[model samples]
Target: MTGTRTVVRHAPGKLFVAGEYAVVEPGTPAIVTAVGRTVTVTVRAADEPGVVIASDLVAQAMRWRWRGDRLEVCPGQDGPRVRRAAAHVVSAVETVARLLAEHGLPAPQLHVSVSSDLHEAGTKFGLGSSGAVTVAAVAAVAAHHGLELSLESRFRLALLATARIDPNGSGGDLAASTWGGWVAYRAPDRAFVLDLALRRGVGEALRAPWPGLAVRPLPPPRGLRLEVGWTGRPASTTSLVAGLHRRTWRGSASHQDFIKTSTDFVNAATDALETGDDGALLHQIRRAREELARLDAEERLGIFTPELTALCAAAEAVGGAAKPSGAGGGDCGIALLDAAAGHDIAHVRQRWAATGVQPLSVGPTPERNQE
Candidate 1:
C-alpha cells in the first residue's frame, strides 16, 4: 500500500424528471438526470493509522478507525455531534473499508476532502448532495485502493451504503450520480440487498450484478429544455417521506391512484423521449404535476407549497410544464420548456424571480472522470 497516489472523483447531483413519490415503491420507475453541479472527493494516503474526512459542505472533521470487523467513528476530545451531512461520508468509508478488509487487504489510512457546488451561499437547492458525495467518496476511496468498479458496481456500493445510513431513500439519485445522463430507475429491494451485503460481504455482493435493480440510461428528449429554479428554501425530504410513511399512504385508494397516474406519466414520458414528441412530454409533465397536487390535497401531505404552485404557474404561462422536483415542500421546481415555443426563457426567469424563484443555470453533466 506504499506510494498510493491521490484519487479524485466527481459525482453530479440529480433532478427528478418525473415519478417522484411513486418511485419509492418497488418496480415503480422514475426519470432522473445528472445535473451540472457536483460533489468532488479527493482521497490520498495519510501517515496516520486512521482515516480523516473533511468536507466544505460540512464544517467538521470525521475521524474513523477500523476496529476488528467494524468501523467506528472517533470524535475529538471536545465531543462534537456528527452532523447529518456526515452520514453519507461515513457510510462510504465504512463500505470501502469493509470491502478491502473482506478481500484480505488492509484498509488504507487516507485523508478525504470533499467539496460541492450543490448549494447557493448556505441555502441548499435540494440537489441530491448526499448521493453525489457518497458516489464520489466511494469511487475515490476505491480508486485509491487500486480497485476499478464498473458503473453498476459503483451504483450498487453507493446504494448499499446509503440504504444502511438512511433506509428510506429510493436510490434514484445514487443511480444518476453513478451514471450521468438521463436515467430510468426502479428502487431496489433493500431487504434482499442488505441481507446479501451482510452475508456475502461488500466486496462479493458488489462484485456481482444486483437483482431487482433496474437502471437504464435514456437519451434526452429533442426540442426539450430543462429549466430549474430554486425556491430559496430547503426542504426536508426525509421528514416529508417519513410523514407519508407514518400516515400509511400505501395500500390506500388515493395512493393507488397516484401510483397509477405516475406510472402512466412515466410510460408517456418514455415514449415522448424516444419519439421526440415534445407535446406528449409537456402533456405528461403537466399531468404528473396535477396528479401530485391532487395527492397532496387528498392525503393532506402538504408536499406542495405556495412557491411551487407559483413556479408551475410561471412555467405554464410560458407554455412549459413544471413541477416540484423531489419530495418537495420547497427547495426546487423544474420546468420542461419547449424549444419551439418561441417563449423568451429570460422572460420566464424574470417571472420566476418575481415570484421568489431563483433560476438556476444547469444541465446534464458528463459522467465522472469524463470531464
Candidate 2:
C-alpha cells in the first residue's frame, strides 16, 4: 500500500485437481492449481464519500455506502441468495473496511472497476470466478486504504468475505487464487469464523486461531501434461453443495467411506507429485475419478453429466486420466497425460470436439510460495 492515487490487483482462477466434494468439509485436504484466467480490480479515490462499483462482466454500475460495517447497496437492490456475484464483492469491501478500522485507518470513498476474462457472453467459465473476484477485490480495497497486508492475512480477509456469502464453501479456490500455483489446501471452519466476525469484528477474527486452516504449496506434476475442457453448461456450486447437505448420505456410513477414499487418493497423489512418480500419479488420478463416479451413482448427486462422462472417456481412450473438476454437473473437467504423449493430447482434444466439449486453452501457473 502506498500514497499512489490508484491500486490495481489481479487474481487468477483455479481448478480442483483432486478431492472436490470431500474438500467441502473442514480439515479435508485437496490439491488445487491456479489457472491463467484472472479477474482484475482497480480502485481509486472517488469524488464523493461513497463506494461505486462498475463491472464489465455484469455490464452495470452499482453505487453503495458502508453502514456500520455492512455494505448496503442502492436501496432497492434485491437478490434472494447470498451467492450472487455482487454479494461477494460487497462482502469483500465490508470485511476490508473492518480490517482498516482496526488499524485506525479511515475507510475512503472510492470507485472500483472490475474487468474479468473468467466468463464468456455473460456465462461464467466456471474457473473459480467468484473466488478470484473476492481475492482481487480484497487486495484492491486494502491497498486503496493504505493498509499493508501479508499473503495469509489477505487470504483470511477474502475467506471471511466469502464465508459471509457461502458458509459451507471450503475456500480452496480462494487459496489457489491468492497463492498462484499448485497448492495443497485445507479449509478452516467457515461457520465459526463467520460468526466470530459477526460478533467480534473481522480484526479479532483474523488474529484468532483458526484450527483447521492450513495451506501448503505443492510441486506441479513432473511428467503429466494438464489439459482443461469446458462443457459449455454452467453449474451452481452453492446450490449443488447445499443440495448435498440436505441428503441423508452426508452422515451415513457411505459418507465415511467416501472421506477415507478421498483422503487416501489425495495423500497418494501428493506423494506422487512430490516424488515425480508418473505411474503412481496416474493411478491416483484415476482412483479419484472412480471415487467421484461412485458418489454420483450412489447418492444421485448428478456430479457427472453426459458431456462430462464423454470428456473423461475421451481422455482415457487416449491413454490419460480425466475427471470433472468442481461441483461438476456441467462446468469443466481436467485431464493428465504423460508429457511425452504429444500426439495423444491432440487426439483427446479432437475427440472432445466430436462430443461438444470445448478444449480450454489454460495451463497451471508456475510453482509459487506464499506472497
Candidate 3:
C-alpha cells in the first residue's frame, strides 16, 4: 500500500430489487443499492501485526494474521465463543489480504477504526454490515499500502472476500456500498451492468457531482420519494440464504414459476421509473411486493415479528404499500408512498414509533443517486 494514512467512508445498508433470497441460489442476479446511513474506516500503519479496534462490534482489541487459506486469529481470551468471533475476523483478513496481493500490493501493518450510524446490536440488519466494513477496511488498507484499484476492481475483491467467508453470500451489499445507489446486476455470466443513475438528480440539485462518473448514457427520472421503516426483528441472513438455495435446487416447479413472474414484475417496476409514471410505478411496486410475499412464503422467509406486521399494515392503511427490505425476519421495510396521499410522511413515521421501529427519512445523496 502507498499512502501513510487513508480513510474510507462507506454508506450503510441496501434495498433489493428481486432475488433477495435467490441471490444465494448461486446464479441469481440480485439488485441492491446504498442508502443514507454509513460507516467510516480510517487506517494507519502500526509497528506490529496486531489489530486495534474502536467500533461497537467488539469490546476487546482484536488481532490476527494471514495463515495461508486460514486466518490465524488471536482473540486474547477464551471468553465465551471468542473462537467463532476470531474466525470471522480471520476470514475477513485473509480475503482482504488476498485482494491486496491481487492488486500487487503488500499488506501494511494496519490500525483500523470503524464507526456507523446504524443500530449497534441490530447490525444484524442482514444488509451485510460485516461485508460493508470489510470493503471499507480493504479500501483503507490498499490506500495505505500504495495500491490503486479501479472502483469496479475494489467491489470485485470485496465480493470475493465476503464469499470466501459466506459462500452463499449475495454480492449485493458489497456492490451497493462500494458503488452507491441503485444497481441492476445481472448474473455473473451475462456481465451486464445497468446504471439506474438515481443519484444525478440529487447531485445536480446540490451542485456537486458524484464520483465514479463512467459516462454511461442513462437519463435520470424526474422526481421520486421513498419511505423506509424497520421490522424490529433481525434476520440470520446466512441461514436464510442457504435455505433459499436448498429450496431452489430441490426443483420446486411452483417456486420456479414464482421467480419468473417476480422478475417480470420487477422489470415492469423499473420500466415504470423510466416513463416518469409514479402512478404506474406505485402499482408495479405493490405487485412486486405481493410477488415477494409469495416467494418468501415458499422460502419460509420474512417471518416478521408482530410489531413488523402491524407496521406493514399501518403503512398500507396510510396510502402506502410496505414490504420487508432485506432477507427478512425483520431488519427493516420500505414503503413507496404516493405523494398524492396527503399523508405527511413525518406523521406516518411518528405512528411507527409505537412499534419501536422508527421510519428513516432519506433523500438522494450527492455521491450516487445522480440524474
Candidate 4:
C-alpha cells in the first residue's frame, strides 16, 4: 500500500529438517530451517475506520471492524465472517489489536497487503507458508502501530495468533521464520496459553512463563549441501495431523515409542549440528526417515507417496541421505550430500526428473543466527 505511514516486513518460509508428527505435542524437540522463499507484509494506515487485508493469493480483500477486543467481518462481504483464505491475517490483526488494547491504545485503521513467493505457479511447496505469513503479518502490523517488539515478543504474538486459529500446531516453523536459520524448537501448551490470554490479557500472557516453549539456534552443516525437491502437489499439514488425532493412538504404547524415538534422535541431531558432525547428521536423517516410515505403517497415515519414495531412493543412490520434509503426503523432501560432489548431485536431479519430482533451488535464508 502506498501511504504516508506504512511498514513493511519480510519473513522466510521454513522446512522441517527432522521431527514431524510427534512434535505436535508440547515440548517435543524438532529441527527446522528457514528457506530463501519469503512472504512480505505491508501495513499502511487506512483513510477511514475499519481494516482491509488483501493477499495476492486471494481474490478479494476482506474488510473487518473492531468489535470490542476482536475483529468481525463487515456486514455483507463476499465470504463468511471468518475465511480460510485470510485466516492467518485476521488472527494476526486481532491478536496485535488486543495487545494494543491492553496498553490503553485504540486499534488503528489498517490496510494490510501481502505477497508471497513460497509457491510455484499457485501450488504451495509445503514450506510452512502459513507460519511465514503469520510471522510477517504480525511484525508488520505491530510495527505500523509504533510497537517495537523484541524478537521474543514478536514470536510469542505470532504463536498466539497461530494458536488462536489452530492450537494443534507445533510452532517450530514460526521459530525458523522468526530466527532466520537452523533452530531446535519445542512447542508450548497451547490450551493453557489461550486460556491465560483470555482470562488475563495479551500483556500478561506475553509476560507469563510458557511451560514447554523453547527455541535454540543450531549450527549449520560444515560440508553438506541441502537440496529440496518438490512433488508438484501440496499436502495439508492440518489434515495429516487431524488424521493422527482421530486415531485412538495418543496413549498407545507404540505411539509413546514413536515420540521417544523421535525425541532421542532429534536431540542427537542437534548435538551433531553443534559439533559439525556431518556423518552423524546423515545417520540421524536416515534414522528419521525410518521412524516416519514405521509411524506410517503403525498408523496408516499415508505419510509417504511413490514420488517421495523415489525422491529418497534417488538421494540414497547418490550417496546422500533424504526424507520427506514435513507432513509429506505429496509436498517436498530434503536431501543432504557432499557439497563438492556436483556429479552426484546432477545424477540425483536427473533421477528426480525421471520420477516427476522437481528439484527446487532453495537454500537457507542468507542471515546470521538469532541471538
Candidate 5:
C-alpha cells in the first residue's frame, strides 16, 4: 500500500466579541475570529516505535503507544502545559482508535510535527492560541489515525480539549481558528463568518480566503494598514480570565454592566466595518476605549497595565484610538489610525518606543479565497 501524508496549517489569532470573561461563567456567550497567525501540523508514516509528536513552541517531544483500548503518552521534557497538552492528544487518539477498532481497522503508527508563529507564546494576549493549537493538532491526529470527522466535528472536539485545559475559554477561539475572516460573534454561541461582497465588486476584495478554496481572480485593494504595538508586560491569562469569571459568577453587577457596554462598543464597530466607513470605524474604536475604561474601573476587567494604558493614551494623542485587543490585562494594544491622512503614525511609533514597547505594523492585505 502506498502511504500518503497530509499537512494542515491554520492561520490567524482571534478576538473575543461578546462574552470576554463572562463566557467562562455558566451559560455565558462569546464570539471570536481568526486574525492572521498560524499553527501547522504535518503527518507521515513512521517505521519507528509507536506514535511520535513534536512541537517547536512548546519544545516538547513525546512518544505514545496505541493499544486497541487506550493511547498512552510518554512525556518528554516539555513544561506542564505541554505535558498536559500531550494528554489531550492522547485522548483524541484514543477516540480515533475506538472508532477504528469498531470498524475492524488498525490505527497507524504515525510521526507528527506541530509548529507555530506566536510572538509571545508564553504570555496571555487573549488571542486564543491554545484553542487554535488544540484544533490544529487534533486535526492532524485525526488525519493520521484515519478517522472520518467533519470540519465542524473536528472544531468541536478541539474545543472540548481546550476547555479541559482552560475551563473559562468560550471555544470561540477554536471556531475562529477553524474558519477565518470577518466574523459576527456572540459569546459561548457560534460566530458567523461573513462573506462580504465589496462595493467595487466581489472579485477585488482582500479578506482571508475560506478554507478549501483558491485566491480570487481579481486584484485586491491597496491593503489594510494599522500600527500594532506590544505592551511588553507579560500577564497570566489563565488566572485573569478565571478571576473575571468568578467575579461574574458572584453576580458582580458592575462587572456585568461593563461587559454589556463593551458589547455595545463592538456592535458599533461591526456596523462601521459593514459600511467600510473609516471615519465611523475610528469613531467606534474611540467608543470602545471609553467603554473599556469603564470596564477597567471595575478592577476585574483587566484592561489596563501601566504600559498598555500609556500606549492607549499615546495613540489617541496621535489621532487614533487604542485599546486592549486580545484578552487584555496586558499583552498588546492595537492603534487604529487614519492611514489616508498619514495621521501621526510615526509619532505613535516614537511614543511606543519611549516606553520600550515594540511597534509591529499590521501592514497591507493579502489575497482572498476564490472559487
Candidate 6:
C-alpha cells in the first residue's frame, strides 16, 4: 500500500435526451449523454492509517476507516448536512475493498480528493454530479489498489455503489458516466439486484449478468447542435420520482399509452440520428415534449414549471426542439437545433436568460479510457 503513484480519473456529467420516468421500469429505454462537465478524483497513498477525502463540491474534508469489511466515517465532522453527500464515496470505498479482496490484494491507505465542474455557486445544475464523482472515485481507487477493471466491471461497480447511496436511482446517470457519449439506457431491476446484493454481497452481484439491463451506444446526430440552459434553481429528482410512483401510474392504460408513444419516439429518434434526419429528429423531440406535457397535466406532478415552459417556447420559436431534461421541475432544459438554425441559439439563450435561465456550455464527452 506504500509508495503508490497517484491515480487520477475523470467522469462526465449526464443529460437526458428522451425518456425519463418510463426508464425506471424494466426494459424501457432512455437516451442519455455524457456532457463536458466532469468530476475528477485523485487517489494517492496516505501518510495516515486511514483514508481522508477532500471534496471541493462539498467544501469539506472527511476521514473514513476500513474496519475489516465495513467502511466507517470518522466521528465529529464540521458539516453534518454534507454527510449524506459522502454516502456514494463510502460505498465506492467499500466496493473497491471488496474488489481488491476478490483479486487477493489488500486494501490500501489512501487520500482521495474530488473536484467538479458541474456546479455553479453552490447550486447543482442537475447534471449528475454525484454519479460522475462516484464513477471517478471508484475507477481511481480500484486502479490505485492494482485492480484493472473492464468498462463493464467499472459500470457495474459504479452502479452498485450508487444504488447503495440512493436506492431509488435508476442508474442512468451512472451508465452515462461510465460509458460516456450518447447512449440508450434501460434500468436494471433494482429489486432483484438489491436482494442479491443483500444476500450474496455487491461483488457477487457485479459478477452476475444483469437481466433486462441495456446500455447501447448511439451515433451522434450530424448537423445537430445542443444548447443547455439552467433555471438557476435545483430540483430534487428523488422527490419528483417518488411523486410519480405514489400515483401508481404503472400498468394503467394511460401510462401504457405514454410508454408506447415514448418508445416509438425513441426508436424514431434513433433512426433519425443514424440517417442524419434533422426534420425527423425535430419532430420526435417536439412529440416527446407534447407527451411529457400531457403526463404532467394528467398527473399534476408539476414536472413542467413556468420557466421550463417558457424556455421550451423560446427554443421552439427559433425552430429548434426543446424540453426539460431529466426529472424537471427546474434545473436545466435542453434544446436540439439544426445547423441551419444554429445562429438562433444566441437568441434562445437571450430569451432563456431574460426568463432567469443561465446558458451552460456543455456537450457530449468521449467514453472512459479502456486502459
RMSD of each: 2.0, 2.0, 7.9, 2.3, 8.8, 1.9
Model 4: which residue pairs collide? none
Candidate 2 lDDT at 143 equals 80
lDDT of 3 by residue, 1-371 (tens): 36466555465556664446544443444455566767677777665765544455666555655455345556465454444443433444555565555556555456666766655563545455666676676666656666566565556555555655675665667767676656654333111111111223211211232232221111223444566776656777777667766654446787677667666765665666657776666676667667667765655665555656666677677666666666667777776665655455666677788777767654433335311
Worst 10 residues of 6 by lDDT: 78-87
After superposition, candidate 5 runs with Cα above 4 Å error: 1-6, 15-19, 22-33, 58-60, 66-72, 75-108, 120-127, 145-151, 189-224, 248-250, 300-302, 361-371
Give lDDT tens digits, candidate 6, residues 1-371. 33388999999999989988878777788889999999999999988887888887577788888799777788887666566767777788887877677667676688988888898666789999888888998999988877768887888888778777667788899899998998888888877887787788767887887877998888877887888988887999889987787777867999999889988898888788778888898999898899889999999888898889989999899889999999889988899876566568778889998998888999888766686
Span of 10 residues, lowest total lDDT, candidate 1: 76-85
**How large an RMSD does model 3 have?**
7.9
- Number of the top candidate by lDDT? 4
TM values, all candidates = 0.94, 0.95, 0.80, 0.96, 0.75, 0.94
How does candidate 5 score on lDDT? 0.57
Q: Candidate 6 regions off by >4 Å?
A: 1-3, 201-203
Q: Which pairs, if any, clash in model 6?
A: none
| CA error at residue 212 for candidate 6, angstroms | 1.0
The CA lDDT of each predicted structure is 0.83, 0.86, 0.57, 0.88, 0.57, 0.84
Candidate 1 residue lDDT tens string, 5-55: 988899999999999988888788889999999889999987688777787
TM-score of 5: 0.75
Residues 1-371 of candidate 2: C-alpha lDDT, one tens digit per residue? 44347989999999999999899889988999999888999999877777888887654677788777776776755453322557778888888887777777666677888888888877887899999999999988888777777788889999998887788899999999999889998899888888887789788887898878889888898888999999989998988989988898898999989988998999999999989897888889999999999999987889999999999998899788899999899999999987898889989999899998999988888654443
Which 10 successive residues of model 4 have the least lDDT summed?
362-371
Q: Is candidate 3 or candidate 4 better by lDDT?
A: 4
Go through the candidates in order and give the clash count of each.
Answer: 0, 0, 15, 0, 10, 0
Error of 2 at 31 (Å): 0.5
Instruction: List clashing residue pairs in candidate 1.
Output: none
